[model samples]
Target chain A: MSYEDEINQDILNSKKLPEKLEISVLRYFWQSNPLIGKKTDSIPRFLRKIDVLSNFSENELRILAKYLHLRKFQPGEVIFKQGELGVGFYLLYNGYADIIVENTEGTDEVKPSSKHILTLEKSDYFGELALLQEISIRNASAVSRQGCELLGLFKPDLEELINHYPVIAAKLLQSISLIVANRLFSLTREVQELKYKLSSYEKDQDASN
Target chain B: MPQISINTKRERFKLIFFISTLLLAFIGLAAMPRVSIPLLLGYVIFLIVYPAVPTLEKLGINRVGSIWIVFSALIFFSIYPFVKVVPTVTAEIENVQYFLPKIEKYVTKKYEELRIEVREKTSFEIGDKYFFQALDWIRKTSTNILLNIPKILASLLEWIFFIPLIIFFLLKDGKKFKRGILKLTPNSIFERFYFLSHQFNKKLGDYIFAKFVEASIVGITITSGLLILNVRFALLFGLIAAITNIIPYVGPVIGFIPGLLFSLAEYGPGTTLGAVIMLFVVANAIDIAIVFPILVSKVVDLHPLTVVVSVILGSQWLGMVGMIISIPFAAALKLIAQEVYKEIYQE
Candidate 1:
């Protein structure tokens, strides 16, 4: 018999009513009910999709979720401005954000021109340096592209987490450190590639001369 | 772009709404002292006791279980003081009023004797106007406070009911309340506001906790010392010392004055009086040498002038509660000021 048919057949063949049937019924209502039950599990499920947070267990993610502050931003609202002091690391929960850096070398005008660095979608995180630095200045501004939701873990929250859950704090710090290391590695490789290109261009100029 | 300007306008509106809501809440709290007083007291107590919940949780108890344990212990300890100390303190305060006349008589007699001696030696007549006026002022204020005791207790009774309930809820859902407030905070100022508030709260908590321990040590030392010496109104005097110790710099002297006057009038210039003097000196010495340095000074980190100014400002604004809260309030203001300074100049 097919799996669904066999389960149905077993239920039909059972002579005595199943024990704890009332509890099973109540639990079904509790879990499947639209209003209350699923909300608590949603944050942990969201955290599970984050690449950096993948190492955190289901329980750890739940604990981490308690420390997060969910913030909503309207379209075109500034998340943070460049050169401003920051103390939060945030993950985009929904919608999109654009990272923009001002071109300081541009001619003085009424407003300094800002260049778009990148757009971040769901599950993307930024401002990890703020969590670790003593005095962190935002290197780039992030503005919501079309209204977004963010889950922010701040310095104060991190401090409390460290005090209450050292293991989880350590895991979080490790993840943040991994992100920083990866970014630094790629940046160094890009600089090396540029250096090689510069030398090759110089040699070609010398040959042409 | 028009979009950016519209967003800016909307953000500004949100910020204004957030600020006005805060102001309205403040006004509401001020309008009703009955609820606010207990809430303020509960918040202070919560700040002091809330750390224990985490400590209990670290021992493997669940969060709710840990909160229950800490709260029950708080209630258990408070009950004894409520039961035993209240009546004795009330009785002592009542008895103190009757004893004040004897102290006044002794002081005037001493002044008369001193006046006679000074006239005989230097031929300069000393006026008793300022001295008598001062004496009258002290007597009137002491009597006024003693008379107000019943009224104070009526409110204290209300606090006894409300504070615990408030504290219980705060312990259980304090984070939820905080998150709720955070949700209301405008996004433009969210991170700055959050960091400043958290820092201020931590500073306030540490300062209050330190002051509490310091006051208790002083109170217990003086009370037990007086009891050992067979002094009258030991509890009353100790309680005064403890309450006044919440103020900085001048507090110890203010606390000592009542005991000094009472000891002189009650026991005269003899061994008992000398011992009383010694007790006040030792208790304050311990506070200055040990407790102040170890507990208080670190938490406040304000200049002495700043402390004095804030205390004056605080007393002018809200009397005793203002004085008690002044240092932390000043510290918070300084933190905000520093942040603003950095933004304006350092950046």
Candidate 2:
């Protein structure tokens, strides 16, 4: 079995804690990382180990850490499906995920397997498009390539954070915008190059005619 | 990007679906006040316990352990009043009932004397109805409260048992529960939701906490003062003061009269009344001096007229309890208004 398969098995084998302890564990993870809470290391140290959350201050990150829910996903599990409604954002913590776009013309939507567009590793953030739009749909499906631990920020969580600590929310918005702007700029360049190539090709065709 | 709400048809459809789901939930709630009451109580308890979770965690306790600690402390505090003050309040009610006829006679005599004096001076006999209307209202309110005492106790008992447990689960699964509710908001409205909810939470929580502290301080002060004066049912009178003090604008006046009457019953108008007045003055001073500073942010800015109207409406609807809740309710309404209007008309 692959390492991914092994991690998936480990997650399954993980002992279920008592309800009270489980709640504490969930709350602790959601509120603040236990590892970072002990003053053993600064949040930036841990954040640097992950991608995306780079722009936020240690103070802002501390507030964010307190509320972000760390979620687990198994290998072969679909995190979300293409064309499905989306309501939350995900920041990958560990393992890998396949960003897949379904072949809508032929295959079944419910089937696990799809065309993989890219592999997202640790620190890679996805599902942000869902956050930007009022009603969001997954353009590409996200499926775990291995057992993964993820930091999940649902819309409500962001809203609550925004409500209490708007400055931090502003910082988070800026981060997301940076990513979106980069993507938009790159896409604009690609489209410009494609348009130039197409026009040149058309001129050649005209000459042949 | 900030103003970008559900721009696409699909997003709008999602928002519509979510709103419809909310409408259905509201309908379900309206059909069941019994369930809704407990649910609302649970939500309120959760809100109170929510900030305390971090404190407990900071103290090196796990969430469950923290919740256990908070609940235990709450129970310990709550049981003191239940065991000590509740019986006193009940016994005082019986005493007040016994004194009702005598009190009525004394009031009637005074009313007739005032009416006679007004008739002689103005030569247009002002009806005793106008004079005694206030007394009648007070008498009716006290009797109503007395009659409903059992029901109030029953509800309080229910809350004591259920609220702690509800608070426990709420703190445990609060984020998850909130997420479930938030899932209903389409991204378009989520920002608006975020802004309004934050303002609402901060203002309302601060207001409630400040009021609670004010009440406790007032209760203790009045109770202590009355004890020093050797006044009867000092705890009961103090509790009354604290409760009425929660109602804005006219609360202190309402609270003062009962203490005056208690003093009147004990030592006539000479000694105890003077002591009572002095006690109130000192208590008000402390409130203005200390509590105001602590509650500067918590102060629910409302027009005096708004307060009076709300108080009257609240009294009409829910008696004294209604009156107490009405001021805060009006304040909350103001917050909602500010949120909606500000968002709607943003430059």
On TM-score, the leading prediction is 1
Tens-place lDDT per residue, model 1, B83-170, is 9999998888889888989999999999999999999999999998999899989888988898888899999998898999999999
For model 2, residues A1-209, the per-residue Cα lDDT tens digits are 95446556766899453344345655656678545455323434556665456777777787787666565555555566676557668888789877877656564755544576888898888888777787787798777775676676767667666756767788888888888888899999999999999999999999999
Per-model C-alpha RMSD: 7.6, 13.1
lDDT of each: 0.90, 0.73
Q: Look at candidate 1 and give me any clashing residue pairs.
A: none
For candidate 1, write residues A1-209 as lDDT tens digits. 75446556768997454454456656777788676646557888899999998899999999999899999899988899888889999999999989988755556564557778889999999999999999999998889988999999999999999888889999999999999999999999999999999999999999999
Query: Which ranges of candidate 2 are over 4 A from the true structure?
Result: A1-49, A52-66, A69-209, B1-7, B20-46, B115-141, B296-299, B302-322, B327-332
Off by over 4 Å in 1: A1-40, A105-112, A198-209, B1-6
Best by lDDT: 1
User: What is candidate 1's CA lDDT for residue A58?
Assistant: 91
Model 2 C-alpha lDDT per residue in residues B242-292, reported as the tens digit of each score: 988888767877888877876665566797789889998899788878896
Consecutive 10-residue window with the lowest summed lDDT within model 1 chain B: B1-10
